[model samples]
Target chain A: MSVLDRLAPELITGAPLLVMQGIAKRYGPVVALEDVAATVWPGEVLGIVGESGSGKSTLLRMMNLEDTPDTGTYTLALPEVAGNLFDLDRFARRQLCARRIGIVYQNPHQGLLMGHSSSGNVAERLLVAGERRFATLRARAREALDVSEFPLNRMDDPPRLLSGGMQQRVQLAKAIALEPALLLLDEPTTGLDVSVQALVLDTLKRLQRDRAITMVIVSHDLGVIRTMADRVMVMRRGRVVEEGLVDQVFQDPQHPYTQELVHAKL
Target chain B: MPNSERGAMVPGAVVLQVEGLAKSFQMHHLGQNLHAFDHVSFTLRAGEFLLLKGPNGVGKSTLLRTIYRSYLPQAGHVWFSHGAGRTDLAHAADVDIALLRRREIGFVTQFLIARPRVAAEDIVAEPLRKAGVAAEDALEQARHWLATFGVKRDLWRAYPTSFSGGEQQKVNLARALILPPRLLLLDEPTASLDVGARAALVARLADLKAAGVAMIGVFHHPGDVAALVDRDLMLMAKEVDDVAV
Candidate 1:
């Protein structure tokens, strides 16, 4: 049975799947992020939009436990786990990052090592997730690549030989090969052509819908933010300036920063 | 010369032309051929921004590498025309052509980086070292380029890999453009850039074009191609389509 199935129906239906309280991060004299509080419920997509240096990336990294917050309370909805992300032990957090949470970076090159082949890239994550059978892992990787629309016949080609769009599809396949519950996408389609961007976004939407994977997408493109988000958070100067449903944020933005961002792209 | 007069190039006066271009990769596991580019062809004018666009595995990046002579084309011919001379790059000696490449072409890859932990200022200055320019002068020029892209001056001695994605892209652009070449080949130059940094790149490319420096931009973003390209050349799944923008 799935983790969700084992939880109390009341807890599964009503509680926030992930919650952050008084989250803050600092670097020397600079205040990167401060007093950020948010909640991500199951079966929901949360979008984060901000200008450069607004701490969106930093905040996302904090949430993924890639960086430690100076002060914060993070509680994830993992019944099998005993503590929050910050409270978890080293091995536990590593397990969580590798198995439950996955990151898809904007630059596809960053997601996978340049030296590894497509099959190797996919296998690395599956191996880390404790799958040891070689034949089973290879077959699972192939199936995942097929699901992501990757041309599986070129499984051994290194990333350098693949086009940027193709490499991204492979990256997506690797990220989802383990069936992670939370996927953090950092401007996933920022540099792709519009036609290619459309396809990637469509694939992501389909995967989210079919698997009910909770996502936190960080981007400066309002077009992408509008298309994928259920709820939107507008950030500025390391704080949440405004928050609302996607339609509400786009239609009646109350914050000046959000308004500026919307108009700048226009 | 008038604009119309300048637009005219003699028949077969192509500076860079490719015909029946094809390349394939022999995959290890699948044990089959992966065609990087399939029978792609295009003729580029001397000073034009020819944008190549396509979905990821469509061989757009491979086409660029093939054109630059970095990746040898398994088939077809790439002809480069220079004043009073024309040479097929496929037949040129690797070392001699590499020297030509350094002087006449500037190619920036998607995974651009400097030496292991090299300072940003030094990285930019590396290209101009043999130009007889003073070290201080080269650094000044580097700083000028960095400021144009909104990179802080205090980060000059800092390594770019330690910087953010946007910042590293700016440094990469600065390094490639510090010593202007006749042809600039950019692969997704603004991939990690913010709006501010991207605008700076657009403006710089515009200035380079105005100066009659030829550029061939391989970009995915329509906004980027619209900003810098004079024409669009697309590499579809296995076909090449050239269209004037």
Candidate 2:
């Protein structure tokens, strides 16, 4: 079948879900971001890549609304709330992020609550949202764990006792449990074993098939970005150097910095 | 006979006029000047198919880039027909060239550079999207073009990066022709195709020519496009021997 057939023409028709323009961020003498602009269309995966100090993580953090930009506009256009998210107060933005966005960090330890059991960890956000019934929270947690392909028998185990991959799976379970409009992943498989990384990436691939869940992924691993992202943004010195289709950027990189990055990997 | 002036006899308005075009690279460290081609001139009219023939490194592809304004012409004038008149592309401002590239010209290369996981249909539909066409309408039209080019329905969803060379070329052609620019520059588009695929491509070019989309192309096999070509320009690498390195 044609790719468009699988997408259902109507699935991709709409205004962009998020728009960021002229976004700049700085920490005293350190510039984390500068004059960057990007747009995230619903149902498309945009990959941000660069070397260590290129601000890829900063950009992803900004996308998740965890950190605000010093100057620029970030607009979140959703079914219920459509306006410049930058202008909203912290309390309102935090509320919006809780409901509309999900995030996965590079380290499983950072994303998961090791003290809680796997099931509790997954259902924590739901509990915070005021789901008080014990049976319903258990059901939702189990369902999300199943979606991430984590073993059902391990649901009661604390993430600290589970393997690295399983810990990340718990994080995945929690992130998708909310079914937010957008999912932001920062180095989703950075620290796992080579074998475990493959498993985690496959889980990401399976979850990625649901086009309705738009994603913005940040990775320093070119191979990971090449495999998962439909479009890529190459960052250098806190600025976006090149943005294009993944293959286009890899095969025919426009900027000199991007060329060096692509060549280094090759 | 190869460089014979035939555009004068073609019954259409001029689409491209290149006069005394030349390009060379300066090898500063090597203390040598590498000359690609020199004293070349040609005219292409609307709806005409112009073929460029040359040996390897003879600047045939460079000439096409010069006309497309991808490279600077060391000394020349490239007059392109736009809206109602013509602009000397050699001297046109960057903004003017950008506008013309968007609305009037397209350049297709030998290898396909596309993103992985992006369906071929979306790749073909990209030019239209850049032109502000709606996604649904542009995608519907892209499907039609892919079908016309004989890209399999199953392959439409496959990534173009995984396709065979010939299949990639077909995808490349579909993208360049989706918007049907007034002038199209193709560099070795038929380089890797088998026989039947080459014929299918020539046939498609013939249809485009009939629709008045003028074209300048460099092909590996002249026989593949002979029937569609309105004229041919033969270019040769300029011999330069003096060097200080």
Candidate 3:
């Protein structure tokens, strides 16, 4: 079945969970991002590609409404709620982001508290998602760990003692613990070696398939984006240089920059 | 463990040796005990890169602490053998170990908790200062090492606190390399770095290995250790095994 077919019929009926139109952001004298438009459909993985200082992070922040864009039309079809993300007040935006979205940082060490155990790491996010019952939190955390292919037997070990690959898996379990509708992964496997990177990415793709978890993965590595993304948006100099299906963008990239990236991959 | 390839040098000329090392802690508050390291021991040659691998709480930290003389082991002896000087550290004085650390060993802990908000350059110079080098000469040596580690000249004066974890790691690395100690101990040195930064650090560590600066790297990730180390030192429940390269 197609990605949209996996989603609930109600969500697919002309309802884009995230919609960004002409979003723009500036930091002092520098314009970090400008004129970015995209749509994240339920059960689909959207890849965002850009180099350092190219404002890919700014775009990801704007997508989840973490940072307000200077000027843009932004709308989110959140579960049981709908609003313009850019226009929402602080509390409202935070509430929406917390309930419907989750973000995983690139630096695995900073993403999760290294002092806490695997179960503790997963439960922290569940508690934040408003699930406070101790037994329920444990159940959910274990379930998430199972889905992410994490070794549940070693759930009591602190993150610092776990292997680097296992640490990244704990970060994944934290993000997906609450079954967030939209997941944002920023260079999820950057520092990990090839074997660990393969494991983590495979786990992510499986969860995205089984749970219909829509994702927005940001990466400087084109290979990473190509592997996970159903739809790709190329960002450069704070703008959308190209946007299309992954196959179309990778096979017949329209932008000259896109051509260079594809050529580099070969 | 003994070094089999003792050629012109004496067979017992191994730089360092440990036999049946073990450590445990009594948690008085919980009325329970924690075994940090158990029956773990290995040998270090003049320039060997020893990589320690295990899960969290599996005693990697404890092993490093024991080797660096920070935490005394409950059982097992840590000995240093170099040239005519053979020192058994199990019964060595704390002050003597401290002196040895200052003069012969350099250590980098896993966490980067800043103590002094000194400039990156001066922070590296502190070790040389303790070694009795002139302040001006120490600063020049520090600058050379910093440049070697790829820290820009403009950023030399920047406080380590202001830099990212990777930058701070480079500073720590520079500090450890400035003294040119006989042995270097690292715990999770690349945990906080990105791909580019990690590659740079690994490249530098390879150079250090070539120069025969004996090192013991405690790493949680086998992949990271696999890239730079020559052999694996896997820590099982209460024993240590030297996995072949």
Question: What overall lDDT goes with each candidate model?
Answer: 0.74, 0.77, 0.73
Give per-residue lDDT, candidate 1, residue B170. Answer: 85
Q: Which residue ranges in model 3 land beyond 4 Å of their true spot?
A: A1-13, B1-245
**Docking outcome class, model 3:** incorrect
List, residue by residue over A43-92, the lDDT tens digit for candidate 1. Answer: 67889999899999888887778888889988888777655578887788
User: Worst lDDT window (10 residues) for model 2 chain B?
Assistant: B1-10
Ranking of all predicted structures according to TM-score, beginning with the best and ending with the worst: 2, 1, 3
Each model's DockQ score: 0.01, 0.04, 0.01
TM agreement with the true structure for every prediction: 0.50, 0.59, 0.49
Per-residue lDDT of model 3, residues A1-266, tens digit only: 21111112221235667888887888898988888887887677889997787888878777667778888887767656655667778877777766777787787676788998888898988777688799998898888778778898988899899988888788888887777888989888888897678678877865764566989999988878877887788888988887665655675455677767777788
| Ten contiguous residues minimizing lDDT sum, candidate 3 chain A | A2-11
Going through the candidates in the order shown, the clash numbers are 1, 1, 2
Task: Give the per-residue lDDT digits (tens) of candidate 1, residues B172-193.
Answer: 8888887766667888887888
- Measured by TM-score, the strongest candidate is 2
lDDT of 3 at B1: 14
